[model samples]
Target: MSLPLNEQTVLVTGAGRGLGAAIAAAFAREGASVAVNYRNSGKAAENLASCLGGKASAFGADVRDGEAVAQMVANVKVRLGAPTTIVHNALADFSFNGDARSKLDALTWDEIAAHMETGVKGALNLIQAAAPSMRERGFGRIVLIGTNLFQNPVVPYHDYTAAKAALLSLTRTAAAELGPFGITVNMVSGGLLRTTDASSATPEAVFDLIAGSTPLRRVTTPEEMADAVLFFASPWSRAVTGQNLIVDGGLVFN
Candidate 1:
């Protein structure tokens, strides 16, 4: 049987601020026990947990580290419960100013590797750590946080976009392998979200440009995109798996 939202424990990585925090808040609003995972911003994470109330708690773990992530998962099981849902929302340090972004000529392998460490390897570590209990329970939900830049590439944030594309591939293959065990893997890709900490660097003109182009005549918000994540974790999407749900206010039709 599928676990109800109130009965499930959800671990949202890199949730100390911005979009990740919004995602964690959405899950908490639905009565799920939320593990707000942060790599460095403990105070922010703690503050969010206190505000969330009802089984929400802060945890620190560099998602890039396998052992640390596993240990964090273990600790979560003790403090909350075995995590049945994972929203891999961690992001490498980045500022969304296309004017300052690296051009292909200046971009290095190390730049690309940084995003991969969190987006790809982090997902692998999380699945390895949390999948056992989920498999035993015959149910799980893995929602990867992705970007619409790969499709739109309006600004061509090469390193960040490449890593998310790789995550999309992993999302499909992982879904096929884990589906028989009742664990669904999917991706929620959002376009340049309005007012995220990273996107705060984006100029006002840029937001206006995007808003004008999108069919909805507005840029997506972190809270709105976060709500799309809840759909994947809920029983309503029981038949859905390996799909990439774009929540960009009709900016990208995928």
Candidate 2:
């Protein structure tokens, strides 16, 4: 039951740059028509689309808004095709500077809610909007981007980690519900990626420390993680669902 990548349409959210961009590129390489969805990085997204050529295009939509997401999907259907594969990789405005993170005592509910709005709520919006089309087609692939911190929590990124934990729950539950409709829901969790917009603030020493701790002895790149994402959407993983594949240079084993 391997999907013919050349015949599929993929929608990658927050794909203007970073891991999202890499993921979009991976799918395009497989001959899938890709919709690079971005909230604010319009220029970057368009540039990436051009780089990918005809099979890829940039779309603007805030996943947090259900109506906007619906519109985005509609647009994709018109410009590309109704997306049979969706990658939820959008992140709220955040930086990986541990020193700037809110401590437990100072962490406010609003801060936590901000992450939820994008992670959990946004996922819900995407599923609701895309599921109908997938159900009609009797095929769909939904991949949620997650974090290794949910398992290790070494840095105690309370708010960000908590939202991801919730997303994991959604991944399993959604998988169970959508299975009958031929939709697979899964997650790809990664540790601190070597260099992404969110992790740009991390010092080089931190990267070296993390790399040393991992069995691979190197930081995983966004491109590496993006490759893992492609597996879930490919025919090779047709029977796999409701699972989380962690891609962090073997730092944490699940």
Model 2 TM-score on a 0 to 1 scale: 0.99
Tell me how far the alpha carbon of residue 165 in candidate 2 is from the true structure, in angstroms, after superposition: 0.2
The digit string of per-residue lDDT tens for model 1 on 1-254 reads 48788889999999999999999999999999999999989999999999999699999999999999999999999999999999999999999999999999999999999999999999999999999999999999999999888989999999999999999999999999999999999999999899898999999999999999999999999999999999999999999999999998998899
- lDDT score of model 2? 0.95
- List candidate 2 segments past 4 Å from native: none
lDDT of 1 at 42: 97
When summed lDDT is taken over every stretch of 10 residues in candidate 2, the lowest stretch is 1-10
Global Cα lDDT for candidate 1? 0.96
Candidate with top lDDT is 1
